[model samples]
Target: SRYPNDLARYPNARITFEHNQGIRERRKMRVNGNLLSSYQRQTVCLLGGVLQSEVSGMSLKLESPDKQVVQVIMKKPIEEPLEGLLEVVGEVTAKLAVVCHGYVLFPPGMSQNFDMETYNRLVELMNERKEHYPTMASC
Candidate 1:
């Protein structure tokens, strides 16, 4: 992309802090070198556990331990359906599911980012407490 006409150019003048320190460059590097390759596929990771607690609109990423791409969300996409999520646990063959507010549970091995153990545990905990029927939705 060419520089916008609105940007003023001064010969031998220092650019703003963004250009001087290469913050954008570094951020791009971090995204490409570390997060973009595997886990997140260069996208942001969103954790289910974090989304479950909110009562309002929000956005977050669920990143792996190694900066792998996982999941990204600009806002809470759906409502969490808290059901007998624990009953499914211990069933290794049982498909892993992702529950979102205003959404339904999604089978595992489908989503790029999420922690199995943590998510499962959280499901079990939330299932025990949630009473309202969540609207069916998917990842």
Candidate 2:
């Protein structure tokens, strides 16, 4: 499939494919060093819980630990029946950027935070709530 031109509005931008069956994603852009060095991948890991919530329910509300500094509530994608996993990821990332006002944080120690526990938890959670995921119109 051809890449979407709308993504070209941002330089160095690449399409990220969030496969429905797994956490691994195929990135459209080339990168040096370990691919895991990429910020997008790390962001995806950190937001696993939040994303799961969105997929499981009508909306997700994120807040800081203290419930003061940060608070973001996101409704499920208005564009229902996403084309596929690619579209699902693209829309999720776009909405996340908006919620963060485009200034995302990547703590130095966070990349490896997508440990087995977190991954397994996400899988379990998503599986438990599979029926709530948006319907896919077509692949």
Candidate 3:
């Protein structure tokens, strides 16, 4: 009934509908340290090695796979000692720092032989071709 004549004309055509909940959700993009400035004010996901952590200050330093380091300001003080590789999800600030919403810590030795350069390349490719990746597409 919604498309009476059109559905009859294209009998085999498939129709897909998307529902919006009236809330705008920002999509998180995977990024490296060097690309932080470009995504200022936007939320992003960063994978890096924990360089240093200041629990008192609620901040920490991370070194990306590309070897670029950046500061991450946490929403709350760290409750545990963070080490090894960490994946931080947060919004980027004007000063090129991330205000972390949450993080995941990879177990030690897991990242001991991790190849960062290749991973960084993959991130770049995914961002460059967001349309090809359904998860990355805005739609």
Candidate 4:
């Protein structure tokens, strides 16, 4: 009944819903400082500790899970005071800097218990097994 014309033309034909693959492909992939250059110009999610902020509040230094420090440039002046750990959604530039589109600040005290080395290992594992885990491949 959904496709009345198609049903009328072929009464015995089966109808099935097809998912749009493009939607899943558009999700931002998670990456660390070491992986930034490889995903240049691509939108991605990066989690890091805030090392320093510029006086203009348009940029800051982020220490990635791998202990590499990279610059993060915001599309707009930062409205909130940045501290501790933050997750940035942005595109990687040619210079390996992240041009932030948006970001999420972790709650106070959360960073004290966070383990960077373990998280880095997990990221590497997910990337290595991307083919086997279709959902994680997008992260």
TM agreement with the true structure for every prediction: 0.21, 0.20, 0.74, 0.75
Candidate 3 C-alpha lDDT tens digits along 1-139: 4232524443432222123322125577888877888898887878899899994959999998778888999877887788777877778995458987666565565568778889899888877898875332111
| Residue 24 in candidate 3, Cα distance off native in Å | 12
Over 26-91, each residue of candidate 4 has an lDDT whose tens digit, in order, gives 666677788888788887778889999998989999999988898999767876678887777777
User: What are the per-model numbers of colliding residue pairs?
Assistant: 19, 0, 0, 1
Model 2 weakest lDDT span, ten residues long: 82-91
Indicate the residue-level lDDT of 34 in model 1: 32
Cα lDDT for residue 117, candidate 4: 89
**Candidate 3 global TM-score:** 0.74
Candidate with top TM-score is 4
Per-candidate Cα lDDT values, in order, are 0.25, 0.28, 0.71, 0.71
lDDT of 4 at 6: 22
**Predicted structure 2, TM vs. truth:** 0.20
Off by over 4 Å in 1: 1-33, 37-53, 65-71, 81-105, 108-139
What is the lDDT, from 0 to 100, of the residue 12 in candidate 1? 21
